[model samples]
Target: MSYNLLTSIDNNRLKQLKNFKTIILNGNNFTSFPSILYQFETLHINENPLCLAPPNDFINDKYISATSNLYVQINDKYEEKLFEIYQQIFIENLTSYDIENLSTRFKLSKTDMNDFREKYSHLKRENKIEILLNIWKQKRGSLANSDALYKFAQLIGDKNLVQKMQKTYLLARKIRI
Candidate 1:
């Protein structure tokens, strides 16, 4: 619906809607792109707070409307680079306890933080770290750059971890250049 408060849609049930080729989800509170929307012939998802990047399969602009006004989409290569750097940092120098510390410093919304704790807290440390970074990047977009990682490390007051982050990032930059 165009003006309903639908935060999410049931893909299975929605798919069963006979003769409905398009779905208009404007003015909803969807923070993440509903993956199932791609199955529709047309989608109107503007006016929603869709921060997370759409799936790679949803690149066909013909079926979807403008969502750029609501969130900045980072280049896929850049997103991969950021994830690689953070993954290295987390794998080498951080533990679950350290991740917990970092999560507190993320300044994420209470609902987001709670969702992480409820749904993702029991995941393996590495996966948990990845999910945390993904959440941060989606919520903050360009603001969730290397500087934010450095600040999170600094907040933990682990000099060794901070040094490792700096060294790792510098090495990554050197390789890119």
Candidate 2:
């Protein structure tokens, strides 16, 4: 059997809807979703400019799934890139001093470092870069001494910084001071 549902008022569907386990609404104009949608076991509402605020019923109902077009796609890409960079950095065991030395060696602006910190909270948690550097000096460690410093220098594409870091490592080793 085939069925069709139509209504002008957004609430009308909710009021009339009954005995249906699944419903698919596509290519419709909806500023906000009705709470009745939460009653359905499965609902597919795609291609609608729903308000940014998620329905309270959906949030309260743990079983219901609501996917927003705006957040899901962009967040997914951001998360993927974040993880990729994180793995590369983690494998080399990048330390705080290494990050700072590399930043200075590469001439990375404060904004760039801030952006990296915002995107990768794990680095902050690992004690590589504290949220408040001066407040927690003793917890800080040097990445400048690490062999991974070379790999980080190469990633930044700054030959000058690479050379400077190499020179610093050599000088520190020779002086043993």
Candidate 3:
């Protein structure tokens, strides 16, 4: 499956494709090479090893030549900006109740909302916000850019936070340009 558009894969699924001569996991967010893929004759994960540290074990492995290199930096700057916006909101003296309210503003699906709450219940308010933002980012995919973040602040009806985030977003854009 060269380009099945998979964002993630699991060990069980890899087992099913074990007999294939070549496997490509290009363009996904793998922090390290999947161990199950080591036996394949040709393995490709061109855009992966997204985490700061690159996997070094298979650097000399003959069958896995393509994945031998390392990523110098994380690629998704948009996701980083979204997290920064949420961090600003959480740090602006928002009360616990207000932070809890903002969590629901993402308009996540019913299942996602419930799953998010249950999974992140033990985290601090700030961590919970970060987790919520991650879920929203995953749900929105490429659409979760600065503009969508601005709209989310508007939806929260916090004019001051909206203005601050807007300014930061614009400054980031200018710097990037």
TM-score of each prediction: 0.48, 0.32, 0.46
Q: Which TM-score value belongs to model 2?
A: 0.32
- Write the number of the candidate with greater TM-score, choosing between 1 and 2: 1
Taking the tens digit of each residue's C-alpha lDDT, what string does model 3 give over 101-151? 675677788798788778888878767767777787788887876567777
Worst 10 residues of 3 by lDDT: 66-75
Candidate 1 residues 1-177, lDDT tens each?
877866667767776875778888887756456566766678776655433456545655553454443234323344456556765785567653566666777767889888999998778887877888778878888777766777777777777777888887777555333
Model 3, which residues run further than 4 Å from truth? 1-100
Candidate 3 root-mean-square deviation in Å = 13.8
**Tens digits of lDDT, candidate 2, 96-171:** 3455554454445577668656766475444543322222222223332245445655676655555655665565
Please give the CA lDDT of all the candidate structures.
0.67, 0.48, 0.62
Instruction: Give the range of the ten consecutive residues with the poorest summed lDDT in model 2.
Output: 131-140
Clash pairs, model 1 backbone: none
Ranking of predictions according to TM-score: 1, 3, 2
Off by over 4 Å in 2: 1-8, 64-177
Sort the candidates on lDDT, descending order: 1, 3, 2
Local error of candidate 2 at 137, Å? 38
110, model 1: CA deviation in Å? Answer: 1.3
**In model 2, what are the clashing residue pairs, if there are any?**
98-143
| Maximum-lDDT candidate | 1
